[model samples]
Target: MEYRVLGKTGLRVSSIGMGGIPLQRVSEEEAERIVNLALDQGINFFDSARGYTDSEAKFGLVFRHRRNEAIIATKSMERTREGILQEVEDSLKALQVDYIDLYQLHNVKSLAILEQVLGPEGALRGLQEAKAQGKIRYIGITGHVAEVLEKAITLGEFETVQFPFNAVELGPTEKIIPLAQAHDVGMIVMKPVAGGAIPDKNLALRFLMDYPVASIIPGMDSEDQVLENAAIGRHFVPLNEEETKRLQESIKELGNTFCRRCEYCMPCPQGINIPMVFLLDGYWQRYGLKDWAQERYLAMKVLADECIECGTCASRCPYGLEIPRLIAQVHRRLGRN
Candidate 1:
């Protein structure tokens, strides 16, 4: 696979790395196979998070046997020095590794949280302490807001920045990419396929390869996905004129009303699976899989109709999407009523 230097960290990583989110959906054996297959295909960068349930533990199972072959990166939502230090220890224990390659402050989506993390007793201090103690090699930040990330990178504290950057979500290109390039901070891209909203995975990934990103991590849980994504990196071809036009057409069709499934709008007080509802709704409305989508929607224990319009999810969403209204729409399309 094609390898690129992760900005100023100087670590060479595969252009097509694996994201850890979908690993939570697979069994331990399946996760092991998928991760091992990715490594065999020359994908060396693996990113996980403390909040992705057992994702860290699943990756640890594979990294323990082949630690040297992979560059492990994980993040925590904890914003304080004490909490982040504990998170670092927990990540090490979960990953079965002595030192983490990169540890990021998860989802610093606001200037206020950014300021808090950079404060005297914030998570940055914890990461600094971890770096000094050899607990982690480099510090990074992840979030969905371009302005927030733009500000965080200017402080010169983080070595890398990660956020959603797909054909449909082009907000990062407005300023984050240019400023990150200026600061020499590594650019790790998440949701390269728009969280499965983009049908042409190869086209979407190739589009991102056109930029100066360190890695484009597409979440994979199956072996076929591993091979497909890895092949794109190995061949490394730019989009032709016709292919570019096709991608543009796809983007125009997608518009900006869809959810990217970043899960920032989560933990609905009513226990609604907000992203899943939107995902199924996408399948029904966009993909014309009404029966299929409706079946899954019916199976959900906490349906979109359960949403109480508390607006908690909307408040947390980085995109400022009207989540309650969207959930109600999903119920109209998929609910039994």
Candidate 2:
């Protein structure tokens, strides 16, 4: 696999790092197979988060023996200094590592949350303390919102930033990326496939590889998928003009339906999270995989079928979306009615 220097940290990271979100979905044995196979392919960067449910422990099981041979990064959402300090200790014990290569603020969602982390007694102070104590190398932050992430960069000196970047979400490439680059920050991409929405995986990955990013973490879950992603890594192809046009067209068609998850069209009078409800809706509608995702949607007690068509959702929607109508359509499509 091709590698790039991870910004100022100077660690050589794989062009495609192993994202840890999906590790929570597999058995320990399956997770081990996937992790080892990734290492065998010369892909050494593995990222995890405490919120990912034993993902760090699963990675620890195999890599603890070869710690020096890999680069591991993990994160937590604790906003308090004491909470963050405890989180670092917990993650170290779980990952079985002396120090994390990069530790991050896990999705500081709002301006207030951002301020809390950067405040005098805030979590970033704890992160700074961890670095001084040899617990973490570089400090960073990750979030889905470009503005929030840009705000994070301005809040303090961040060593790295992990946010969504793909054919579907190029807003970062245009804005957030250049800002991070100017700040000399490492740029790692998360959800490069738009949470599995892009039908052609290699095409999606190649689009990201075209950029000068430190790495793209695509959540490798199996040996086969690892090999497939690795093969592309060895080749490192960029989409040609025709292919790029098709990919852009695909993105345009899938764009607004994809729910950037901005929480903009929110506070549905019927208590629906307009964006989240529509995100699940997109999973069922455009993907034509309702049966595959139906159980998960059904399991959510706040299913969109409860939307009352009070027009409040539409009124508050910055994008001027037809909120209640779309919710009904999605509910009917998912048979959640």
Candidate 3:
């Protein structure tokens, strides 16, 4: 696989890094197999989060032994010095590693959160402390909003910045890309396949390689996905003219207001699986999988129809999606009622 220097962190990471979200769905043995397969294929960068329910441990199951071969990265949602300090400790234990390669402030979506994390007693202080104590090697930030991420990186505190930069979400090209390049902060591209919505995964990934990003992380759970994604980096190529047009056409179909399936809007008090509902809805409406999508939607134990309309999910969403309103629309089509 191709490797690139991850900005000022000085960490050389695989161009096709492994995103940890999909690992949450797999069994411990499956996760171990997938991670090992990725390593065998030369994928060295692994990113996870404290919130991804046992994802860190799943990674630890393999990383603990292959510690030297993997560059482990994880993040936390805590915004305070004390809270983040505790999170770093927890992450260290969960990953079964003495030091994390990169620790990010998970989804600093707004100016308020940016301020809180940069303030005197904010999470940045804790990360700084962690770096000093050798718990983490470098700090990075991830978000969906370009403005907030641009501002955060401009402060020069973060060594890297991660944001969704798929063919549809081109907002980052306007400013975040240039700003990160200027500051020499590593640019990590997430949701390169638009959260599995893009049908031509190979074309979508190759399209991202055209950018100045240091790495592109597409979440993978199965061995086939690992091989497919790793091969993209091993034999990197730009999207040809016809391929670019096809990708742009797909992008046009996926207009804005589509969920990127970040899963930040989770744990509804009413127990709704918000992103999954939207995923099935996308398959039904956009992917021409009406029957298949509807079957999965029916199989869901909890669905969009159960949303309580409390608006808590929207508040947490980085995209500012109207969760209740969108969920209602999805339920109308997918809900058994």
| TM, every model | 0.82, 0.87, 0.81
Question: What tens digits encode model 3's per-residue C-alpha lDDT throughout 1-337?
Answer: 8999999888899999999977877899999999999999999999999977799999999988999999988999999999999999999899999999999999887799999999999999999999999999999999876679889889989999999888766778899999999999998988788766787999999988988899999989899999999999999999889999998888767654688765678779998878778877876775455666778788888777777789889999887788899889888897767
Candidate order by TM-score, decreasing, is 2, 1, 3
The residue pairs that clash in candidate 1, if any, are none
Query: Which has the greatest TM-score?
Result: 2
Q: After superposition, how far is residue 148 of candidate 2 from its true place, in Å?
A: 1.9
User: Number of backbone collisions per candidate, in order?
Assistant: 0, 0, 0
**How far is 33's C-alpha from truth in model 3 (Å)?**
0.6
Best by lDDT: 1
Write one digit per residue (lDDT tens) for candidate 2, span 116-164: 9988889999999999999999999988777788877665468898888
Q: Relative to the true structure, how large is the alpha-carbon lDDT of every model?
A: 0.91, 0.82, 0.88
On the 0 to 100 scale, the lDDT of residue 239 in model 1 is 98
Flag the better candidate by TM-score, 2 or 3. 2
Q: Candidate 3: where is the Cα deviation over 4 Å?
A: 255-326, 331-337
Which structure is stronger by lDDT: 1 or 3? 1
Worst 10 residues of 3 by lDDT: 283-292
